[model samples]
Target: MFGKLYLIPVDLGHPSFEALFPTLNREITSTLTHFVVENQKSARRSLKLIFPEIKQGELSLLTLDKNTSELDLNPALDWLKSGKNVGVVSEAGVPSIADPGSLMVKLAHAQNIEVIPLIGPCSIFLALSASGLSGQSFVFHGYIPIDKAEKTRFIKEMEKATGRNQAQIFMETPYRNNQMLEDLLSVCKEDTLLCIACDLTLPNQYIKTQTIGKWKKLKTEDLHKRPCIFILGN
Candidate 1:
């Protein structure tokens, strides 16, 4: 008997949850046994929302702490030892990219467990599709710097990458998003095209593509305080 590992990435809060719940339930019915959630609270909250009929014996929900890098993989290690199926989930988006689940994934792979990643929404792809940039060649720079000097350096690097016709994508925490935008507008050339994909796949989802010149005149106060993906091109 082979054990299983499901990598479930939750994009939006409700809709993504709704879409994944049914599929996850079917897996449970088929003998899935362990779930590795970002945290205990998130695990319980998601289970209650998706599968209220969760049983104590059929599943083991391991809640990893916020400092995921420091999290001990002993639980997951033990589960693999028992030949039990394990599922990995992130708070939002796919697990392992920007989440702590990658560590577990590496460990599981070393043990030769079956790792299957389920289909789900990813902001990076969504932004790339709508950005009108070079999809064939793009680099996800992940989160950018918060400090002024570091942020400037990062932007310069991104501009250089974009000059090579590669779509450069990065994200910033919501509260600092506007400031980041301001910095981009100030530094990027007027003709530099930028795409801001906000609240993707949600009711208030916004995808706008424009040059630095155009964004400078737009009123940013109106944008909702939700996380957004920023894409830029030459």
Candidate 2:
């Protein structure tokens, strides 16, 4: 077997998070020589909260701020050179998917490092599971366009995909949830189903499923600031 380079997902710390925590702690204590995080401060806070018993000195945390497309993973590269196992984590959700850790994963693969992933709660999966959409085939578009014209074009394409029975999953920044919903309501047909999976695994969590036309009638301000996963099916 090869040395492990664990790709741990620490998004909202869902219920499954508690179960995965001790396993992560044990792995860190036993095999982790270094950690690569998107944000050092948050990583430290999370570590202190979840694995307070683990000594700080045993882990070397490297903070990465570059976009996955622009990321220069020299720090992670150097860590692996020392024959020490390195772990990559994002602030939320699985790292590398709509997150910056993809670059590191790509580099690690090229360098022949064994990349191991731990199963945990993912808002996307949770959303899809409850969306009542076809799961056998789907596409995660990551994010929709910010520009009106671009977004319109994107929605048209998404409609085409879903109309043929493929589930479409996408996300947006928390504050823009309402606008995204509005755009979807305007572009999608009345029969199109929309699933808004917000703040999964957190208190006051919400999963609302409705047709595009019906969703427009609901007030947006009522929805709190939440990490959300949006799904559309035709």
Candidate 3:
């Protein structure tokens, strides 16, 4: 029989493993020596933090990022087929949601491997829960377009959908956060509800929802290097 595929969740900027993950999750992750990760360096660091007794050299890590191809993931599958339990972790948050680790999950299902999802922080759901938006019916548009014109159009369309009672959630690269905010203010209606959830699960975490008109009056600073989630509602 093939070993199960564990969908591991990492801290969302929390200080320690105990703070974000349950004891069971840590225990499961500790026993697994094989991991399919988005980034090797960060993955190793996270594993060490979760299981301090772990020997870094003993763990096997396979990179699965945007650039990873189906051919590149076969080796990781081979480990599962060999009866070694494998863990899938993202750079942050839950594996396979916004990250490319979904590919592995799909393959696991195809091969009849049991996939277990461990609980932890997920910025998308966390932000939605706090935003007081229509969580019952919502859509998560992963990342806004990089181009100015295209992003503006995308924001406007999401706003229209939100006005129809569907909550719209999206994110932007940390460095482009301020720029994205600027475009949002310029393109979205003045009375449209907007929520900005920044640095979630961190000490300086900020989450607020208000109309675009209200947000325009506030003295905004740079969110140039902070992880953020933006939600729109009517």
Candidate 4:
């Protein structure tokens, strides 16, 4: 029989894994000796936090980021075919949402390997839920355009979609977050609702939904270099 694949989710900038995850997640994590990870360093650090007594030398972590192709994941695929259960882990939050690891999942499917996903914090859904936007119809466009002119066009397009009562969810690199906020303020309508969810599930979490006009009146420099999610809605 072919082995199974487990999708493991780590913490979101929070050190307290016990608060965000169940005991069963810890138990399952402890059982696996192999993991397909976004970054070996980050994955190893997180595993140490979740399972303090875990032996680093005993585990095999295969790097599976955006640049990873099917050819790069042959060993992991072969491990599953050898009836060995493997885990897929990301740098933070859930695997393959906006991060990497999807290619490995597709390969596992082709080989008819059973994939089990453990529940954990997902920034997109968490941000939308707290944003008080129209969650019924929402879309996540991942990262926005880097060019200013193109970014303005993209923001307007996302804003226009909001007229249909749909929430537009998107994000940016932590270092570029401040600029994204500025671009949104300059483009969205005055009354259009904008939600900024930063440092989600962490003690200093910031989640506020305000009109574009109201946002302009507050200090938003705190978002600089912080993990954030932006949503636009009517």
Runs in model 3 lying further than 4 Å from the true structure: none
Runs in model 4 deviating more than 4 A are none
Model 3 agreement with the true structure over 1-234: per-residue lDDT tens digits: 899999988877766776688888878977999999999998887777777788888889999999998889999889999999999989999998877789999999999999999998899988999998898799999987888788888888999999778999998989989988999999989999999998888988899999999999997756889999999997
Looking at model 2, report the run of 10 residues with the lowest lDDT sum.
13-22
- What TM-score number comes out for model 2? 0.86
Which candidate, 2 or 4, would have the higher lDDT against the true structure? 4
What count of clashes does model 3 give? 0
Report the Cα lDDT for residue 217, model 2: 79
Model 3: colliding residue pairs: none
Model 1 CA lDDT for position 120: 68
- Write model 1 residue lDDT over 1-234, tens digit each, in one string: 557777766645555555444465545534555788886667655555545566645667776545655347777768777877787877776777656688788877887888888766677888899889889899997788888998998898898888889999998888778888889998888989999999877877889998999899877644436878999997
Q: What is the lDDT of residue 204 in candidate 1?
A: 78
lDDT of 2 by residue, 3-87 (tens): 4578776747544436445466445634565888898877665555555565677678877656434345676777776677777
Q: Residue 7 in candidate 3 has what lDDT? A: 91
Candidate 2 — which residues are off by over 4 angstroms?
13-30, 67-72, 217-221
Give the clashing pairs for model 2: 11-92, 11-93
**TM-score of candidate 3 against the unseen true structure:** 0.96
**Worst ten in a row by lDDT for model 4:** 17-26
- For all candidates, the clash counts are 0, 2, 0, 0
How much lDDT does each candidate structure score?
Answer: 0.76, 0.75, 0.89, 0.91
